[model samples]
Target chain A: MTTALLRIPAVRLATHLRRLGAAALVVASVLTAPDPARASREQTGDDDGCARDGADLPLAGAHFAPRRVEGGVAWDARFVVASDAASSFRGGALRFAAPLPAGEELVAAPGLGAIVEDGRIAGLCVGAGARSGRTVLASFFQPLSGDGASALGAPIAAGRAVQIVDTSVGDARLELVGAPLFEKHVGFVAPRAVSPGAREEARRLAGVREDVSASPIYLRGEDARGGLTVRVVDARARAETSAIAVGVAFAGVVGGLVLAARRLRRAASVERADALLASEIDAAAKEPAG
Target chain B: MTTFVTILDIACGRPIPAEDSGRARRLQLVVFALLASLAFAGAWGLAAGSQAAGLAIANLYKVPMVILLSCVFAAPAGLLAWRLSGAPVRGTDLALGFSGGVFGGTLVLAVLAPLVALYYQSSAWAGPLLGIGSAALALVVGTVMFVRGTIRRLPPGAPKLAALLPVVVTLGMQLLTLLQLAAIAAPIFPERTPFSGGIDHLAR
Candidate 1:
């Protein structure tokens, strides 16, 4: 009777249930496996919750890449803070010599808090602790000429302390180097918004009509402590060059082939014409009249 | 109307075989030019925002660069595929089919271009989503048409599975080339960097 019950189809269903339960256990174990290595940098913390003195102060730096936009050039600048604390900056003013013109804006990167106030930029803050090293905190977009000219007046002073202050550090300043930053020849850097949020943020901050353009340019320097150095640079140029080279080479090969094919066609037509003429003469000779 | 239907048919997986394969090859040269122009326009529009003149300027130099890259990478892949697929296709036919596929894809993108612009204006998030979505759609439809057209022309009784080998190889090669090209043509997304520093924007 037990064998008969086991032979029934309904009784056989238990095997399927057992298989499913096994699968569920396997899946749960797989899902709970140790996490793989992360692509992002590990966040570091300073031993002291607050900076003790100048030796512990976070370093600040800035660099620029010249970009040619419609009718003029624009300076794409990045401001960074090399910090060693959980909170590198609370809030402080970023002073540029000439007040930014109306219609021109300083587009702050996502996550780095920045708000424009009184024709100046303020409310700069970093979330990660300083042990992470160099963080590109902000970017300033200024057109080279026209109404945008006043944004950076002639003989703009650099090395002037762009102040970062908070209750912990009290105050830390990033000095700017006074001079014109321009490259003789610059290629176009097409902006891309990879994620939906980033795309939206860039459009929101940079204006709906203009794409946000920031070429990474690593500037290496020590914080006030003179121990750690951070490097950032725009590496987009290499990709741009490769893309251009591939485009040009492909066009050339295809163009040459097209020209060659045309030439071959013409040659074939000429050869056929000569053959037809020779055949016509031969037929006339064979006819013996006409 | 007939041409429109044909295009729709091609996109839908039933590509019409070329009656005059030679002429189809010649037509591809025209397609090549159009492809370069349209691609540049799309790229420029994506990059320049409201700058109309910038699009034209970009078309002048950048279009050629992108087309060249595409050809360099795609042409050889196509050739190798053709050779591997028992040389069923003439060089010209392969060129025509490949160019046709790309052109068809671009045509779809061209229609969506205005929508992309509009989306960018209304919401920032929509722009990238639309761009990526349209591109993905175009590549799929175009590649499907190309592969199907190639298989359709094969001699009767030829194993259908064999045809897929070349198509797969060609696609893989094309992807690598596009990636290389994109590295230059498009800016890297700011956050996708290897150095994703743990900066909690949430703290703000």
Candidate 2:
């Protein structure tokens, strides 16, 4: 009878459950199930904190190339998120010191979305299936206030935060690299075009690494608030030249005005004399057929 | 050097000497004044175009060429007006006065050149605006000087306005021509404006 009962499907399932107690079943199920959120954190080993491990693993790296636009300067920016086979970036945020100019949009690359709120870019996300190692995450153009060569030294500040899976890290400073070429009103040229001496001095002031031949200069530095800032030493020379030109121009204007005034005065005297002589001649001619 | 000084004196409204009153002497004075005008205009262009080396080189010729072309285009109209008006003023005398006006105008540009360059490097809006302002100021001053120089050469019996007929026609033609020329010579300023490209740019 027992054998016959065991042949029934429901009775067999009950017998199996009885053999493996409910407690044992629950424990096995819990141990076998996957926890994707925790697994991601464990694989990346970023459990401690994002900002604390910034030195060991930078959240992202940024590169900027400044070019002269119609009204101001446009900084062509590229961002590369830190990633490895076991872990990948999920999203990030960027806040500028000053609000971006009105009507300007932050254009992000495919597989990423940039959301601009007020002056900050928030809720930036990396799409699924993105490459893990040294992948370019996003790129956009940022407008700055300046014209011509003067735009070269304009101040720049941006706060970076990166998200890895469920763990979001704020205050993750980025490594900034300036492009090898700089834009002049005439066209694009290397920093050496500004004079070899100036280029050397600019590189020294910016503390660019000597080994990096591809990027000779890094215009950005960390500020008091932990945001990236731009430093341009070559702009000082430009300012000095501008001052001298203005001084010379002012003196020229003054001298020219004085000279013009003297000439006008002399001309007035000549005109008066000529008018007197002409009137006398006319009077003589009209006087009784003289 | 002496000839240059004499030309300068005449441009400043001094009476022409009897020996210098001949058509040949008047033509010489006009040529000298024109050369001087070019030099002054070139100086201003250097300062204004200092923003870029290529632009600086171009302006060296561009600024003076604008003045030269304006004069060239306007001279024939002035001569025609002189014949029609039946004025006692000689055409050569008119030419001399016009040349003097050109010199004066260019002198102003040269004087303001440094300031323009300084501003161009330092300020965004002010630089271009100052450039346009300086050019306009030079034009007004030149117009006044032209009228004064021409009137001084007129005979006592000649109607002043009638004698100035050629001057009026030349000035009008120059004004019209400069407007178009400014368009052709676009980018006198670092920033492009509606006026830079002239009527076509504005229409678009």
Candidate 3:
């Protein structure tokens, strides 16, 4: 029986071994493969994960200057696109929340196009040339019915394809296809005609009490669709004002109390003297006639 | 200056001089005290209203007006009670004492004015509470001063209860009148309180 078993066909033995090996390989792959669902849930759990993921995307900067057009005031808007040397960006739209002024045309860069809907210049697109490092896109003129300051919204970059060289993966490049990216900087360049006082008044009217001297206001969150959210920097100003007002008021109160107390004491002493004099006079009047 | 000194004497419970105790002189003293009271109360009102310019201007008149009106409405009843009780206390002397109390109370308010202004701009909750609290404290101090001043001015052998009758009547009437007047002068505080709208608000 042992001799018969050893004499089994070589082809059959090889076939059986191959089948076992295939089954083992399948089990190993099943155990080692990463779970896409678990990875996605963990990424969502991190608050700053979105920002970290799009770290290679090109950042947008916008400066709006008011211009006196024939009809009214128009905003001479300029957009600058920039990114790190290892990253490239192409084919993105700069969208605005507020509708463009009626009958205004968007004149963007040579390769870019305008997305108009309902007679409004809704967005601008980058068609060609992968932007890397710092690049000034184009200056566009947007007209408004009035000053245009109140009507214009901050610009947001959306649907942009970003490609970054992944050093962790040994020169492997990663391409993110069409993710909404936020502007790094947004600012209002007051026209030469506008006075500093007027600009301050305008800012006050808009209810922006933050001091904008440090840096141009930038979008703070990962959500590009929420428009521009400004971080208030003038809390120190408010606190200082309150401190000064309270300090002066307290000083006045203390001084007044001291003065009043002194006057009251003087009055009390005079009253006591008067009472003593009155008593002395009464004593004399009551004495026997002489 | 002499009148101010005389008012201060009354607040301190010093005896009224026999010569100045005449009806005419007492009336003159009352008038002077009234004016001084208005000035002091007005200063406090100005501080309480520092939350807004319009309110500040309005309070300049409203606070004094409230005090004056309360006095006008309450003094007649007080005088009648004095006569019925047969307190042997002269009406003019009573009026002088009442005005002195007013002066003392308003002086306290003026002293706390800067504190009120400080709180008004700095704290939302504390501002209105402090305004109302200071006023209430002034009322208590004024009442104590009123009772002491009047009792001291009473002739020897006069019934203390008889003299106190008018004092009680006058204070009760003044408080009632003041509550209504404060309601009429709505928005005295940055935010409304139970006292701001008076009894009707409390009922609601």
Candidate 4:
């Protein structure tokens, strides 16, 4: 009797549940992939977090690269270096070919722009890009160290920041610098909310709108290490030099596509339901309202 | 309320014309613009005499709801424009427009965000801009509608685009962002330097 009950038609929903369960697993893995490895760094007391003083030479194990960008600039050198805490700063390096003027340099980088007497780099300038024939960009996130974080303290699992120099023909626009451009620090990050579609799930997703403007903000030592992020600047694809007007117009196009998806999904569901109801109606009609 | 819901229902059923669709968006944009202009005037007012930041904050909070309502039209207008209007939407046009919109939107925010900070400090008599906000709001809405409207009426093959056009466009933006492609050119420029020291220690 127990085996017969298990084989009953009612158990068919079990197959669907299993399918859904597998889908959930796939989504979970995709969204929550392993976090980036935090290179361990020794943390000192409040004042002497890293270096006793500072050093200017390229770190022995530090990773650096030079690539050509789409803008007018000839080329750019990129760096991602890890260092010991001897210097208060984790590590430092900049593009010699294109540097910001001294005055602007102090004001440009949010946490790592100020120059020192010795010239050894302090404060990590997250992302760097050039405009007007000069590359200027920066993002300051936390360090892998225990006590030694970026300008912003402990990693803010999802924290993001951006710095940009707008040099459009008429006026300027904010460009994403060190911080991740689309995340919360910019006031319009997503993924703070992404749930499986509800039973009546609309096909399209919605996003909170935010202004992408750059302001020089004041951050303290306790603020960095925002979520480990990798901001990849790809020029090989020539994606950046793409026209500006095209980007703006696409926002409208994006909105339209979202609506279409919702309607199509809804229509498909409706059609299935309609077919089932029609078959039921034919039987009911034959029975004559009894 | 029922009437409003019905209006929303109609708006949802078919894509509204750009002129018609932007009605809500333009309202919100103008309100935001007006609020910005008001904040600007209020700052000038506070400096001169009246304290208007508090009132400004209160109004600022209301701005989102207005924006939410206005945003209802975004997807619809985009659909209708793509489906009904006969226009050519090249890859470049779509990209430039969205980027420009975001850029303009940011400036609009910067202009008004100051009022929020000010209102935190001042109590009553928050920023006042009965006249400026109204006018600014009108001008901004009108301008945005005009700009967006032109796009909707792209030369010809717009409406004929496969239903996939809109989805592809929308998904492309999010995908671009996820791939961290939005700021593709960020790695180079004015060049990068390793670090800058603290202000206090350096000055000393």
Candidate 5:
């Protein structure tokens, strides 16, 4: 009786464990779905999860110019705060992802924003709600020799990102008007070397963004870089030229041409020859009859 | 060589006696097929550049292959056109007509061989542009030849509309064959430029 009673309780405990395991699996999936960055649709300036609404305050444009410095590369970046939001942007600070390689010393120009350790820019005060358009946030030059190549990597590669925070909105981040990452072209250069994927993406985005026909521009090239190249072959194209083959094809053409010519000439010759034979036969028949 | 020249003249639509037409037609077909094959060889040689000799030798197989395919694709259409047009409908006649048109088209390319070589060596756009132009020209010439040649061969009492029927059927068949020829030879004469966007950087 005691053994039977214990077996019943043990079966109940096993059933409870199975139920618990299934419930935990469902909860885990719900929590860890996908990367938050890809799902962030905060472009509309909605107060989705903003502790403070920095939207509509000021739309800023960040422009970066890359230069070949004596020892390394130098960035001449300018941040233009919108003229309308003069007061709000006056005291706002700007930040940029450091493009310097590790262990390289950075020397900022005196008028440029104060350079804080680890690539942060400060001390840029926007004028009172008076002067509006472009206020230079920071301009700096850095020597990039020793570990420069590592930090610079490829000079022509994609550029470092720029981040902005408006002071009026309690230092809340402000979304810029253009893309966060600016592809830099140093001097007079061809159109930005867009990768194939980027080109397709741009075409697709343009289709959605603009009110034009949805025919995506298909570009062919040697590589993903948008250098253009053309393809010539098609279904109508043919190839069959070997010595023997050429000889055969040539013989066919030449022989046919020759035969056609001969036949044409012989056409008249044969008719004439037939007529003469007929006359001779007729004359012989008449003489015999006479 | 003189006879060959004369036959070319005939293919280009020189009038010949009806009695001699049969042999002339056969010869015309052979000449065009040969010329077309040679043009293909030139294209391969030009594209091959430094490897011209090897590519020329290797790609020789494409000549017969394209010809056979064109004939196979075009034969039935030729026969169909003859029947629909109420012509005498001899298999050989239709075959010869279709082949004649192809020869006529390829003749343009074969004649322009030296220019094609120079273009391939120096310019990217020239060769393909010429090739395309030659193809279009040949198609028109060939279609006309097939129609006219077929009409001449028809029985005395055939309907006028019968003339139109062969055009549609034969041109369609010939185009299909040409398309296949281009596709098969594509490996040898890969598309250097499908569309012209701008002057290539290298060209510039």
Candidate 6:
């Protein structure tokens, strides 16, 4: 930091700095504009002490942009559309217990080869757990509202196609919970109860408040740093397509320029020809006078 | 800064020293970060559920169409950036990097877009990916052009009318390309599009 101080300041340094700062702000907001739609509100947990507010966690922790979760941390989602019928599907689930960090899996299923409780979400660690990076990215719900075979709560095979069911942070993905998580389509109820119980047990073990809200419940607890839990609802900003459209337009311009240059060259050629002809005509007229 | 103070006086917006510095670096990083985010969305968003639909639309013809349409819109601003900036930047390198970034990014997105459509809520990735790819390409190219020293620095306020010339040229090119693609695609849509993954898909 001190190295920056050694340079003498320019007269326009302030102006440059201000402009740079403004430009940077615009860039940052535009970059992160796709923030999650989930409410990051520090709402109280239902005796389910999960962990810190999602805000405190580095974005790397969630493996999803804030805009992705701004939709109120989807407890789970079902596939609604399929981009390809020929794509493969695999079911995957991750189980979570209380006092756990978001995306942290307390238990693992066999698809990823039974990883122990390590808190890593998509290469990001939620807590200090040994060998947590081994945890595979798993989804717990059926492909929402779509027509494709469910992998059924299996390990996400990096390049292998799959779907996500859980959208919220600090929530465990239950392999035995959602329809996609179950083997042979064991119906939704059977697996959900099993997974919910496991999640509740983990919450109980953590000695935090229990979250029991309707079909889906969100657990609020003191941040790991013990900060107040302020319920923050996030709104995902819409990504504008016009900006991209601008690029397409730019390509056209490059072509147009070539054409215009050619046209200009042609006109210049004609103009030169006219000037030469006029000079010759003048010479011819002067000869007669002479 | 004088600019800051002046802007403050204008009451358009105001920022303190600390706020200014903090915001600057973050903003650039964030803007660049958008491509990454858009990439993720493209690879996995609505496509999580609709792979076939995505593949069905992935046609070579789409590239020309994109190039045509985006150039029409982006060329002008890109030219502005090239012509107006006081900072020294290479024009060719900027163009190569920008175009590379855009095309490479687009190609990557295109390769995976079909797969992404396999999951639910992933289809949203397509348009955004296309848009980002286009912008990323143009900006990268523009920046490269600026950096390569293709655009000479103007004397104090010398660009006057000349500064905008590049932009005008860019607009013309973009308009022509889009018009061309729309014309070409009009006759061979649905069939030209790969959303169906039928005989044409096998032809690819």
Best by lDDT: 3
The TM-score leader among the candidates is 3
CAPRI class of candidate 5: incorrect
Question: What are the DockQ scores of the candidates, in order?
Answer: 0.10, 0.04, 0.03, 0.03, 0.08, 0.03
> Candidate 3, what DockQ?
0.03
Native A-B contact fraction in model 3: 0.00
Report the lDDT tens digits of candidate 2 across residue range B42-70: 88888877889888887786677667667
Can you give the TM-score per candidate against the true fold? Answer: 0.41, 0.42, 0.43, 0.19, 0.38, 0.22
Worst 10 residues of 4 chain A by lDDT: A199-208
Prediction 1 global C-alpha lDDT:
0.43
Error of 1 at A266 (Å): 5.9
The all-Cα superposition gives candidate 5 an RMSD in Å to the true structure of 19.7
TM-score of chain A of each: 0.27, 0.33, 0.32, 0.17, 0.28, 0.19
Ordered list by lDDT, greatest first: 3, 2, 1, 5, 6, 4
**Model 6 agreement with the true structure over A1-290: per-residue lDDT tens digits:** 66566554753687899999999998887777553322121212121112322211111111111112332222221111122311221222122211222342313222222222332222112222211232223222212222122122222212211222222223212222232323322221122323545435433432234322111221211111121111221111111243345435544554554455455444444554566677778879889663
Q: Chain B alone, TM-score of each model?
A: 0.68, 0.93, 0.95, 0.32, 0.67, 0.32
Docking class of 4: incorrect
Q: In model 1, what lDDT does residue A61 have?
A: 40
lDDT at residue A98 of model 4 (Cα atoms) = 19
Docking class of 3: incorrect
Per-residue C-alpha lDDT of model 5 across residues A195-244, encoded as one tens digit per residue:
54454343342222321211112211111122111111211211323334
**TM-score of candidate 3's A chain against the true A chain:** 0.32
Query: Arrange candidates by TM-score, highest first: which order?
Result: 3, 2, 1, 5, 6, 4
Best by DockQ: 1
Clashes of each: 24, 0, 0, 72, 22, 133
Report the C-alpha lDDT of model 2 over A1-290, residue by residue, as the tens digit: 98777679887789988878977987887788685322222111122222222222223434444544554334454444444522644433333334334444445345443434553442233343332454433333445453222212212233332111100001111122343343322211233335545444433433333332132233222221332233333323443454354435434544553465455544444655666687788889889962
DockQ of candidate 2 relative to the true structure: 0.04
Instruction: State the DockQ, from 0 to 1, for candidate 6.
Output: 0.03
lDDT of 4 at A266: 48
Off-target runs (Cα >4 Å) in candidate 3 are A1-290
